[model samples]
Target: MRLNAENIKGMLLRYIVAIVILAALFTLPFWGGRYIVMLVMLMGMYITLGHMWNLLAGYSGLTSLGQQMYIGVGGYTLAVASTNLGLPLVVGLIMGGIVSVIIAVGLSYLLLRMKGMYFAIATWMFAEAMLLIVATVSFLGKGQGLFITEARKLVTAQIYYFSIVLVVITTIVIVVLLRSKLGLGLFAIRDNDSASATSGVPQFKSKLYCMIISSFITGVCGGVFYMSQVWVQPYASFSISWTVAAVFIVVIGGIGTIAGPIVGGIIYVFLSQYLSTLSQIGSLNMVILGVIAVAVILVAPKGIVGTVQEKFGFEILSARRWLGKSLAKVPVAPAPASEAERES
Candidate 1:
């Protein structure tokens, strides 16, 4: 009873803190300058990206090296739809997600067959192929890129709001999904696929669900990011750097934890920005970031948030099931009578 009460109190406290933080973020643009808003906006996008990647690798055990494929597809879809097809930016955004889902479904047949490094490599190859196709396709602006003139009409504040909403929605979806039956199945598969399969967990279906959700959200994020940039180039959109960034954020923040990506996104955005200003170091900023990641891995192993939770035994966003409480709720069957009692 005491432990359950403590858990409830902790959960309530977490909710309150989350609400306060979200409120501040929503109102930030009103008081904060354009630069700050833009920075936060970028942070939100990367956080969403990290969440999707975490869903795949950390939860579903799908270590994809080519999420950029969805990003590029989303960006290109937005560009073509809005620029050429004369659709609204909102419609284009939706189209981007839809197209990515379709593509994910098609590729899942082949990609899902492989496991480990083979799956990762196949994803990367597919992304590279997409880049080449976009570069060669004349309607996609060939090697140059397409300008999202419509996006230019929207102000920074509006874009910031969009980013904020995306972050909130993405976070909510992940939390709710993690607490559902599908989420339980995903956890099972992540721990051991063969065992999960034997236990009657739908392995392919669960993974496919994760992939589809991740791809759709990632696609939408890509659309929003490129929309903010007002341009989309094949090379930039399809760069492996997207996957690298997601990996760094998740690993540095703490893989398999909801709070990990959020913390990692903040650290990444600020650190990258600060590093970019150091012209003296030139392009060595990436190297510095890599070193930091290595240091974190060596020291904590589980990441900052993961290490903290392990040592302290608490979670900010607790997605784990309370085994004691769960079992307590299940009705126990009466024990069988002893042979002597039965005879009596």
Candidate 2:
């Protein structure tokens, strides 16, 4: 695509904004107090989780309601590997992701058989089953959860930096994938799997790729989360709230867009914090959040980022501007000539 001067200016503005925001975030620890830094770290964690969910449900058309399966498993894996087995914390964290990947590979065949609601239901059931199973395991604290040993020595600042690193890694991984041919194929499958397959897009493979990538990232987030807290339990790890939070963030921020999760995570985290401090309404934070989500749905069905892009032509994570090429590049077929014209 040809870039006019106006387009060039817009691209520069987007890049500048992105860079400035990142720079501020990375430098905040130097000036911000412990409480503020902790809040930002929590926001980054939520953003990382939300991004993985968006990749699978928003971009790959796999709406899973059992993502907590990975979360619980990852947390427990780290607990066992690092705390019990006496492995390095880093190795344990890596183990968490590896375990999630292995399980996802096996689950993909079964889960991929069902589509839409069926798939969602299956995933939820799987998570529930896992919760029960983990509850019965004697070594994993028997539902009481396990405390992370190594992380006990780490201070708040150290954990905050770890969260920042995780967010950066997740964001970079997502951006790189979205700019590749595989991401284009995944997008095709998300829009229309049958059409994608007809166009040789490898629909199953693309969906599988999304699942593996999403699960691995989510698992890592889970590990980091429990490590920072120094505790992990089945109920909290496999809670339905994880899935709900991810869905709420993505839906409110713009499900299909890259920057949507970041926007949603920030809004959700801050709003939750503010609402919880109110004596009269603190207990009803979920209710308040639900109402806000409903309002967003009614007025801006495409979500906050989606609506803004539609109205103002602003897209922070637009691949078109970043890659200097249109996102969907399907070729136009040539028109057939009439018989009389062909004779000439």
lDDT of 2: 0.87
lDDT of 1 by residue, 43-74 (tens): 99999999999999999999999999999988
Q: Best lDDT goes to which candidate? A: 1
TM-score of 1: 0.93
| RMSD each, Å | 3.2, 3.7
Clashes of each: 0, 0
Query: Per-residue lDDT of 91-159 in model 2, one digit per residue for the tens?
Result: 888899989999899999999888999999999999899899999989888879899989899887787
Runs in model 2 deviating more than 4 A are: 1-15, 279-283, 321-344
Off by over 4 Å in 1: 1-11, 280-283, 327-344
CA lDDT of 269 in candidate 2? 91
Clashes of 2: 0
